[model samples]
Target: MRQAYSYVRLSSKKQIQGYGQERQWEAIQMSALAHGWDLSDKTFSDLGVSGWKGANIETGALSQFLKCVEDGYVEKGSVLIVENVDRLSRAGVNRAVTLLMQLLDSGISIFTFTDNKLYEPNSPNPLMDLMGWALSAQRAFEESERKSQMILNAKAKAREEARTSGKIITRRCPSWMQVNANKTVFELLPERVDTVRKIFALYINGYGTPRIGRLLTEEGRKPLVGRAWYPRSLSRILQYRAVLGEYQPTLNGKAEGEPIKDYYPAIITEDQFNEAQAILHEGGAGQGRRGEDMRNYYAGLLRCSCGEGMHIVSSKVKGKRYYQMRCLQYRISCFGGSWNFNKFASFTLFALRRLPLLELMGSRDNGNIKQLNDKVIQLSSRLEDSRKQLENTINAIAELGLNELLQNKYKQLTSLIAETDSQLHAAKSALELSHGQVAIQKEDTQMLTGRLLELLANTKDVDSRIKLNQVLRRYLSKIELEADKTNELRYIRIYRKDGDLLVTAECSHRLNNALFYGSDGTTEAMELVRE
Candidate 1:
């Protein structure tokens, strides 16, 4: 009996519970059992990994497997069972082909269930073995491409439907809404409908989204059967058009949906909604800090003894435009206040020295900046779309004379604009900040891979804590201060990059990564190609 290795893959969660991998495993095991392959050997498997991203076959996994074969871990000419060829690769198609050749050269036999084809290295016809794999892979490529196109087509259809019908076809909605049994249309939760009405009424009475949100929170407005109101939920309530009693105007010949009243119960009359919208569009009164949610690149990340976000707020501190941040919390209790940018930056520079190696997070490849251009374009477009939608809603409310609602919504929209602008400015400013990072990443990776790679290329010493700090702070986590002292010390909380706001929870993505590597984990690292 020959020892055999089995490989199987399922792309998503549904497939896992649906027995996709189980069926594949069973078929391969049955084949091995019937053929009398060695039953005593251990099984090798990668389960519930994607066929879309790197085929779960790249990223050192496949490399280790090939090394195993070369080391004679399995019998020569032994069978490798797979659910199908694509399980081996839906990515790196060319690499998969070359690897197949290598396996054949090593006298390995391949067996698959989808086509019931078998590869026998001893077979007289090399074409039979080669053609079976080549054709199956070709089919996989075609199918994947087809699915990609179909997804695009579906999204396009959704957008088209939205534009033509004056309806934003929601992919998701608030918890207080229930989808019809068919699961396409949505209706208000009867238990929570009054809360929705109150939200609209508050909004219609010149309360901004955030304030209205707070009122709901104070009221303990839990999702019908769930907990507190999420920001998204309050946001939705303030945005719903049914409160205005009409639909948005047809733009570019796309408006074709049933009018606003057809969707949900109206909370505010159209006229009231319009009046509210007008006040909002005109910017009646100031409320909330400008750009409160969007942290400045340096301000929030930098620290002072007080622990409040160091406010780099320009003020006439002896009549000069200066950037600074201070612990707002310290103002009343400890005379905590903002700091000048120059002093704060200098203090932070020393902190940077603690990191033995720093790499800017991104592709370190020469083409990375070019790759980032595409992302910039995509984010820009989405941001613009969001702005436009906000505008349309504001205008719709104004037209209906909902001044109070308009005022409230305008505040939210204004805040969103300010926040977005802040982030855009930070990204632009940090473009330079990332320079040292990119250089460090390149240096580290060069050691890892460039001719006779040194594994721990970035480490300066056994206890080089700051080296990890540089890369981790920028590329891995968004940070927040947890505690601060009058002295120059601070405690912090962290979240994933572009992840959520500063969470107080002790657990974090960074802590988990540490546990993964433990103490003995190899320190060799790859550099990002930020060129």
Candidate 2:
């Protein structure tokens, strides 16, 4: 007897729970029995898989069946039964017809229960059968296309409503928040909120995501949703603007609309968020996987004249270990030599102690603030242009209908608008923080400087060193080291965060003594004039 194989497909989980699968299987059994064909026990079924996108053929049971037929397991002249042509594929006319032709060419006959028709490998009227297949595939394509447009329209409407009114568009909020009964607002979960604040506090106090995760795990604190804390998950939480009460909707994994501010209750202030961003941007927090004893205090802040990081290199001479600061590109560069770590730290501290903190903090003129403001203006102008372009594209689509070029341009504009808006927000936040820095009181600045000095002087533990590194990054921009081979000295230039030269110093190569020089004539020792 001839053999028959059945293929069944349901587009969604809801359809699987319904009578779709059962109905398809019953029809296949009846057709097989009527034709006197031996029904195969192995059935190919794609449950909760989409046929419109051809996922069923690409990775689903249909793909497996095709492989089986190719391998001669299904045999020649075997019958393949499906509920309908659409059940096999709804990708489009050309693709669906191609799939049908492939099966027919392989000497397999297809029987559809919907039309009660059998399509043999060599039909007496091939053109009529091909037309029937085309018509069915076209209908499926149109139906799925219409449904997709409906979903897009619905999402657009929801986004508009969210912008006009403060409506919560999605229930997928931050881990610490939930949409209210009316969907007008998001209420904070008290316990989760506390966890978020604690995470931020630890990060601000010089803890990296890895260290924070370890600390939380040790304290018996669990993540809001997961069983254990992960560094990457914690990092994402720290970067979310939702914590600042902003909602940014996305479509197809790209930002869809303008971010709605105050959409949710603000968990952290803008200052706190911006401060954390600054630290993250600067790579201030030690990201090393070393134990509690961090080796490099100047992990991110120190640099060589060759524009490479200065990493610590340890060596033992006569069974005594000594640490030296070497350039990351030491093999490629021949201009500089290594400096003793202890002497370098002492010279840095000596210069910082007499840094004229009041004078530096009291000055209201900051180049960084001006640059940030300029960037904000540039990005704002770009964002406005992108929005106008997006509006014109939408108008064109409405008048001329959607084309591939117009659709691509629309996606590009939306993505550009989202990216520019994010940059603008960051610039504004940085500007705000810069302004705050200039307005610090003398007493607070004094206390902060004193505390920093104390921390730098007594960094005996790894945690203390890491905290000092993070804190130093907030005020100092970079510490550049250049070797003066002729004078047998190493020159150090310390720059403030505002891009101002704080002081310059020189240390003997022997690691014995050092001299400091200010912009003025003030000096701790003999001043060597630069040619």
Give the root-mean-square deviation of each candidate in angstroms.
Answer: 25.9, 6.8
Work out the TM-score per prediction: 0.41, 0.75
Candidate 2, residues 1-531: lDDT per residue as tens digits? 999999999998889999988988998999999999999999999999999999999999999999999999989899999988899888999999999999999999999987889999889999999999999999999999999999999999988888888766788888898888887667888988988998887787678888888888888887976888888888888888888888898999988656889888899987677667766766636565444567777767788988988888889999998999989888686558888887778777667777676444436454698899899999999999999999999999999999999999999999998799889978887886665444323323544577434745657876667666665665677899998888898888888777887888877766567788876657884322332
Which pairs in model 2 have colliding backbones? none
Model 1: residues with Cα > 4 Å off, grouped in runs = 11-22, 39-54, 58-78, 90-95, 98-109, 113-128, 147-174, 182-185, 200-215, 223-531
lDDT of 1 by residue, 27-112 (tens): 98887887887643455556666555664656534556677789987568788887778887765456557768888778888877
Best by lDDT: 2
Worst 10 residues of 1 by lDDT: 509-518
Alpha-carbon lDDT, every model: 0.52, 0.81
**Candidate 2, position 14, lDDT:** 86
